[model samples]
Every structure is written in structure tokens, then in C-alpha cells.
Target chain A: MYQELLTGLLNGDIRSLARCISLVENEAAGYESILEQLPGNNHTKVVGVTGPPGAGKSTLVNALITSLLEADKSVAIIAVDPSSPFNFGALLGDRIRMGQHFNHPKVFIRSMASRGALGGLSPKIIEVSDLVKAAGFDYLFIETVGVGQSEVEVAGVADTTVVVVVPEAGDEIQTMKAGLMEIADIFVVNKADREQADIFAKNLRLLAHTKHQPGGWEIPVIKSVAIQNTGITDIIHAVDAHHKAVTGQHQRQLILLADRAYQLIQHKRMKDINKQLLMSEIQQLLEQNSFNLYRYINESSCFTQRGKEGKEA
Target chain B: MYQELLTGLLNGDIRSLARCISLVENEAAGYESILEQLPGNNHTKVVGVTGPPGAGKSTLVNALITSLLEADKSVAIIAVDPSSPFNFGALLGDRIRMGQHFNHPKVFIRSMASRGALGGLSPKIIEVSDLVKAAGFDYLFIETVGVGQSEVEVAGVADTTVVVVVPEAGDEIQTMKAGLMEIADIFVVNKADREQADIFAKNLRLLAHTKHQPGGWEIPVIKSVAIQNTGITDIIHAVDAHHKAVTGQHQRQLILLADRAYQLIQHKRMKDINKQLLMSEIQQLLEQNSFNLYRYINESSCFTQRGKEGKEA
Candidate 1:
């Protein structure tokens, strides 16, 4: 089944792509086998959009997708929303916001709930993005349910991270102070028709001024009323500029590639170890307080003897 | 140093208590050793207070602490704040709001930042709470940085969790609809002097009427203006009543105790294992993407073979 899914994904079957994402995101059985087939077929530009809740991120993403489609590009969006604690499902309000685009052939949108996952991105977000890429989307956008710092971490996983903000949320300084300001390749002031838009833009620029870049490129703050579709072209231009800047840095690209490869390998191995470690028997021993995790790690035969000697030393 | 600190903590030395919390919150060198000394001293009651930002949580906590102190109780507060990404220090606004209690001999207030920790409880929060318990506090209040749903996980680690909301923000249905509503042991309608207080209270009562509690206890919604100390005593009484009820249930108490013990032991072992895993050579291997973490775990001889076999089977 896993091999068939991989073949179907590589062949750009949208149904296979959707199934692969569902499998990865839900951790369906045989996810590791699917993941093992991914490394060779996973080249895609992943973009992350994140901001405080109520910043019109979904609308902005819809606008971005429209623009991308205008240029004849296929797009995939993984929009994350907080799950309803009672029902354990996506709130679906975000889905309603993008209802108009539901039937657009050039766009595919999926709503994922945090679902007891820690940090902003689901552990499988990267894997799903890979599947989306393999499905022939020219761009894949990951939108996080922006609560706070976790959103920043989720944005960190993307190749180009766009940090969205509102004009009068009193979070302008807080966002800049939160270090998210530094990570943003593009600063989007959404809901620009609201009062204080100009002042917010000035503050963002001032914050950007203080950020020292070796390449001397300034972070551009674009004002967009996403609901009205204004300033989106400028936003797209800034995104393109950032993509160019990042790809232009040959050394940074190599470092990023190396880091990603390392993470992929680590993730694969950790999933295997975690499956073994979190087994019911081990959990029972842990619950009984009879199992010592340190001792268990040291004595397990799955590891090399060099690791054993290192632990002893 | 850790042993001396532990001894000082157990002997009820206040400065040692403060310094130890600071270290744990900062993940300083000796934090793990402090936790290793903590298990037998787990006697304090932990209560978590969480709500939307600017819901008057800090003020309510201050009022509660003062009321507790009037009864001659020693209190420890762990105020979770969003860390400044630049310096990795707390934003400190929440701590500043409770500054008046900082000098009180019976009160220990420590500000903890999320510090990008995925688990709602910082790796250090559990440890610091242990030290605070060892320092002989009768009550420990953990006030989390109010993001949305994630705060519920922090409340899970506490004995009693209070979800605070304000009048005029929205109706009771909206409050309950918010993710943290179900996590509440006590619902506090803070700023009750506002015009919408009665309506909010009514909505809460209506919702509470529909809730089926297998434990046979209805969650009470109390109205309070923390600035004026209105209904402050009632809030404390309600918290005490809930705490007593939960503690008096033999099955629930055993479950809580068993869960706490498991967490304590697991955390301690993970710390030790993490230390052994971070040795210089292993770090080098990890950097090179050649360190098989599973292999390392399997080969460590310090652990029992049964634990290893359990992992495999």
C-alpha cells in the first residue's frame, strides 16, 4: 500500500497526494514507509504565513493564491486552525472564509487542527508539504493558527516566512520584540483600511531599520487590505525578492540543504525510536515506576557499541 | 552546589528558593540535580489561572495571594510570560503587575518565559514547583501567558485550574465556546462591575446547567471585581472547596498521585538521559548526521536489560 501510494504521489495523482497527506498528518499505519520513500522526491519551495489571530491571514493567503494562479501557478495551502476541544475537529470558520475559492482548480486548501500537537506545525507538516510538492503544485503555503510564539516556530520551518500583522492590535511592538520580526522575509500589515495603518507601517519600518543584515537588504512592510485585494501585487513582488535573495546566497543554500537532510534523517529515526519507547508495555513499566528510562536507553541492543562506550564515558 | 541548594530548599530558606527557581526557569547548569532531589517533597497544592490577555488574571492572582496570606499561608507563584526572543528573558509585564507582593516574606513570585518550549509547562516549571513545595509553601499558583487553547495543557499539570473571563468581552456562550472553558474547575467573571456582568453570569449558569458531571459537582461561576476585591473571598472559598472535593475522592486522588509520580520519575530519567546524550563526541556525531539515537539508547550499559527487551517487544 505504501509503495503504491508513493508511486501514485510521484505520478502527480491528486487523490494519492491527498491520501498521503491525510496519512502523514493523522499518523496512519505505515507512515514511516511512506516517509522513507520521500527523500528523493521532495523538492519544493515551502512558504509559511503566520500572525496573531484575526489578522486576516486566510484572506491574505486566498489573495496570494489568486495572484499565483493568475501567473498560471498551481498552489497548495495547509491552513491550521485550533481544534474544538469538545469535538476534536477544526473550528471550520477558517474554511468558511475561503469558501469562494473552494472550487478553484488551480488551488487546493486543507484545514488541519493542532490536535494535541505541540509547537505551531504538526510533526507531519513538512512531510505533507513534500507530498503537496510531489503532486505538482508550484507553491505550497503553510498557514499556522497564530496564538503566539509557537506560530513563529512554525514559520521557521518554511523557506520564505511571511509574518502578518494588523494596524491597531497593539501587537506591533510585541511582534517585533518577539523575534518574529527578524524571521519575516516579508512584513504584511493586513486590514490596512483600519485606523492607524500608516502609523503601524511607520513603526514596522522603524523596527526593520534596526535589524542589521550583512547583505543590507531592508525588510519591506507592505500594507494590504486583503479583503479588498489591495497592495497584493507589492506583497507578491516582495516575496519574489526574498526568494531571489535566499537562492542567491549559494553558501546559505548549501547549509539549508544540509540542515534539512539532517532533520529528515533524524525525524525518521526518532519516529522509530519513539514508537518503540512509547509502547504500552514500556508505558506500563513507566507507570509502575519500575522502569528507568536512562537504564533502558543504555542497555538497548538496537544501538551501536560505540554509543554504549560513549554513554559510559 | 545543587545538593546545598536542595538542602536549603528543604530547610525553608527563602533566598535559596528564589535563586533555585530562577535557575530552573533559565535552565542553568544545576537545574536537573535540583529536580532529582524533589520527588519526596511533593506536598503543595498547585492551582493554574489562565484566560485571555488583559483579563485581569494577574490582579486576581494578587488578590487571591493576599487573601491567602491574611490566613497566614505561604504562597508561591509561577508567572509564565512570553520570552523576549532577543534576550530569552521574560517580557516581565505580568510580574510587574504583582510587584507589591514581591517583598513579602511569605510570598515567592518567579516569572517564567515559554522560551519556545513546546510543552505548555516549561521543562523547568515542574522542577520549580517541586522546589517551591520543598520550600514549604501551602499553595502554588501558576499563571500562564494567555494564548488560546494551549493554556489548557498547563492547567492539566495542576490540581485545580481556574479559567478567568471578563464581562463585556462577550457572552457566556462565547466564553464557554472558547477552548479553555471546559478546563475550568472554577469560572471567574472578573471585572464584574462592568454592565455585562449579570448577563455573563446568567449565560455561565445556563451552560453549567446543561453540563453532565460524572463527578456530581457542577463548576461554579463566580463574579468578581479584583480591583475592588469584590467576591474575592468567595473565589478562594470556591477554589478550596473544589480542591477538597477532588482530594477527598479516593479514586481521583490516587489517579492524581499516580500521574504525578509517573511524570516526576519520567522527567528525572529524561533529564539524566539527555545529559548523557549530549556529551562532546555525541554532539559531534549528531552534527554529522551519523548519530543513531536509537542505537545509542540500545547500547548504553547503565540501564537494565529488561527495559531494553520491553522496548523491543
Candidate 2:
């Protein structure tokens, strides 16, 4: 069964890719075999598009996909709103034209629900990105709501991060500067037709210039009216330029790959422990008059130390 | 060394408590022995105070502590700012009087630095809270910035959560309702002397009644001018009332204990893996033309599953 799915995914079957993602997301039996056989190295450029609420990130991403499509680049998008669970994408519902790309042969869009963990980004996101990249898309766009620690975490996954903001986002920009300054490679001053757009763009450029990126790529603040489809080509050009400039930066890639590996290892280590079993065990443990949590964890069979089996602890 | 510290901590020594927490946070060698010996069950109430920036959470917490002190109850405060990393508590710096409690015999406060992770709450916070609880304080206050997913997570750790908001927080209240509704056991309309404070308090009361909790306690909306120290007594009363209502809710506690245990297990499983080791390993792996992440995780010794030793995956 795993072999059939792996064969189809390698042969560019979209259904197989979707099925594999579901399997991984649910941690279905034998998912590792499918992940193990995936291609090792690929040229798929992962781009992250993130911004505050009402920042027109979706519209900007839609325009980005449209421009990429003009070049016949296969694009897959992963939409993960930082506030997605609580707000339920109420902000992105009308803004994202993701539904419009449903029947498009070259496009694949996946939206991640938080799995009830409001801890910014999901743990599986890095692993899922690896899986998605193996399907051989020319580019992958991970779009997310720029709240919590997501902006920084997404920067870890994406080759380039594009921060979308509007003319009225002056205050928000000031508040989010620490994270935005660290991660933003390309700044999109979306709704450039609005008042003070040029001023915001200039301020963003000043902020971007302060970051000493190891890849030696200069950050650019592009003014784009995504609603009118203007400046899409210029934005695409900026993405290409940044991509070219960072191509040979091996240490940066090494750091990114290592971070990804660390997360995968963390997930695998935590794979078998079940919450339901934990509940039943605790229910039994709490029956006693004294219930020391630390003692319980130390004595628990699940957490039994393999290396220190004979140690004094 | 662990035995001496554990004895001192059990005797209600403040210095020992601090030292012990440091050891746990650092995961010092043989620290598990200290944890394993902590008292099984104790009667200490953990209260969570969370709200948006400038909602006067620290002030409210200060007032709460002052009230508890009047009753001669020992208190420990763990202040975790959700946006603490980026802002560096620029908002809470002058607002929090954590320094004032340094000389107070009955009060202890610790501020978390987020470990540079902007993820809402740190995983160690739970274990640290357990450490604090074992010190035999009459009450523990966990004060956190109510943004991100913290408000909900804190609710899991706390016996009762007091959500503080100002009269001007109408918009933020609306945006944060989904999370706030689930977690808030008490609402503080702080800075209640301001205009529309009464209306906001009334609206919150209506909202609170919407939740159906297992404890069957009425969620109270308390009006407070925390700066002037008014309403502190009433807030304490509400907290006591909540403690009384939830006293026998065994199933509820079973869930909280299970959640805490699960996090402990996860941390233990992931304890041996190091990022520096991962980077060095990845550097070696990346030298080849291809390095599949899934293959690396599978073949790596750290994630070798004990239960599935003979399996194919």
C-alpha cells in the first residue's frame, strides 16, 4: 500500500500527494516508508508570505501565483494562519482566492488547521513542507497570518519571506518590527493606491537595510496594488533576484536543514505517547491520596530511560 | 546535593525553592531525583492572570497579591509575557512591580525570558509551575500576556483564570473572544472608572454565562480600579469561590494532570537530542549530493523506537 502511494507521488500524481499528506498529518501506519523513499535533493524554492490581519497577504499571494503561472511554474501553497484556529480564517475567507485555483492543473493549495495547539506554528509543518517539495513543484508558497512567533518560524522553512502590509499598517509595523526585521526578505506595500503608500514603502526599505543577511542579498520594499494586479511582475523579479543572490549560501542552507531535521527528530521521539492512555493512567494514579506529578513522570514506563537504566535516578 | 535542596524546599525555604527551580529549568544532572521526592498531593491554588497589553494585568496581579498578603497567605508569581521576547517587557517594565516584592518575605516572583522562542508559552512553564507548587505556597499566580494561544494554555494550568481588560478594549475583546470565552473563569473590567466600563462589564457577564463548564461555577465579572486598589478584596473572594466550586471536580483534574504528564513525557523523550549535534551530523550528510530528511530520521539512532524494534519502518 505504501509502495503504491510512493510510486504515484513520484510520478506526479496529485491525488497520491494529497493522500500521503493526510496519512502523515494523521500519522497513519507505515507513513515513514513513504517519507524515506522521497527524493533527497530538489530545486523547489519555498517562499513564505505572511502579514498582520487585513494586510492583503492572500491577495498578494494570489497575484504572486498568477505571475508565477505566466512563467508556467508549478506552485503549491500552504495556508497556515497563526490565528487560524480561533478566528477560523474569518480574515482570509474572502481575501484568499484559493478556491479559484481548485481546477487549475499546475496549482496545489493546502490549508493547515492548528490541531488545537495555539503554539504559533504546528510541529508537523516542517515535515509536511519536505513532503510537498518532493512532489516536484517549481515553487511552494507557505502563506500564514503574521502573529505569535510564526513570522520567525516560517523564515526558518522558507528560502525567502515576503511581508505584506498596507498604508495604514504604520503602527502595526512599529509593533512587529523585531520579527519583521529578522525574517522579511521582500516587503510588499500592498494597496499602493492608498494614501501614504510611498512613505510606508520608504520606511520599510530603511528598516530592511538594517538587516545584515548572511546571503548578502539586499532587501527590497516593493509598492504593489495587488487588488489591481499591478506590480506583480516587479514582485516576481524581486523574488527571482533574492533567490539568485542566496543560491550559493551553503551555511544558511545547512542551518535551515539542521533545524528541519531537529523538528523531525523531536516529532519522531514524541510519536507513540497517546493522550487517552495518559488520561486513564492519571485517573488511576490520582486515586491515591498523594499525587506528585514529578514522581509520576519519573516512575512512568513510557518515559523509562534507555541510556540510564542502571543510574541512581 | 539534591537531597539537601529538596529538604530545604520542603521546609518552605525561599532560597532553596529558587535554587531548585533553576536546577529543573537547566535540567541539572540528577534533578529527576529531586522531582521524584516532591509531596504527592498538596492544597495550593494556582490562579492565572492574563490580558492584552495595557489592560493593567500586572497592576491587577499586584493588587491580588496585596489582598492575599492581608490574609497572610504565601504567594508566588510567575510572570510570562507572551510578547515578552520582542518587546522585552517594554510594556510591563514600568508597569510590573516585580522588583518591589524582592524584599517582601511572603512574596516571590520570577519572570521568564521566553528562551528566545516567541511560541506563546514555553514547555518548561508547566514543570516550573509544578516546582513552584511543591514549595508549599498557599497560592501561586501565573501572570501572562493574553495574546497568542497563551490564555487557553494557562487555563489548563490554572484553577481559575482572570481575564483583565480596560474600557477601551472593545475591539480586542471581540477579536479575542473565541479563546477568551473558552478559558476565562473571571473577567476584570479594570480601570473601571473610565467611560463605558459599566457597559463592558455587563457585556462580559453575558458572554461568561454562555460557557458550560464541568465545575458549574458562575463566571463572575468584577469591576476594579486596580490602580487605586479598589475591588481587590472582591477579586480574592471570587477566586476563593472558584476554588470552592471546583474542589471536588476530579475528572477535570484528571485531564489537567494527564496534559501535564504528556508534556513531561515529551520533554523527557526529547532530552538527549542536541541541536549542535544535529548541525554537525547534517553538515556531514549534506556533503553528499542527496540527503533525504525522512531517511536520516529513520536511520538516526536517537529515534529508534523501543516498541517497534523489529518493524520495517
DockQ winner: 2
Q: Which candidate leads the pack in TM-score?
A: 2
lDDT of 2 by residue, A129-208 (tens): 87788888888998876344465578888998888877753233454455566678888888899778887788878878
TM-score of each: 0.72, 0.85
Model 1 C-alpha lDDT per residue in residues B111-147, reported as the tens digit of each score: 7765432222344665666678778888899887544
lDDT of 2 by residue, B243-286 (tens): 88988789878777777776666556555555566777788887
lDDT of 1 by residue, A42-84 (tens): 4456788987666778889889888888998878888766554
The chain B TM-scores of all candidates, as shown, are 0.76, 0.88
Q: Which residue pairs clash within candidate 2? A: A291-B40, A292-B40
Residue pairs in collision within model 1: A295-B303, A297-B297, A298-B300, A300-B298, A303-B295
Q: Compared to the true structure, candidate 1 yields what TM-score?
A: 0.72
Provide fnat values for all models in the order shown.
0.04, 0.53
Docking class of 1: incorrect
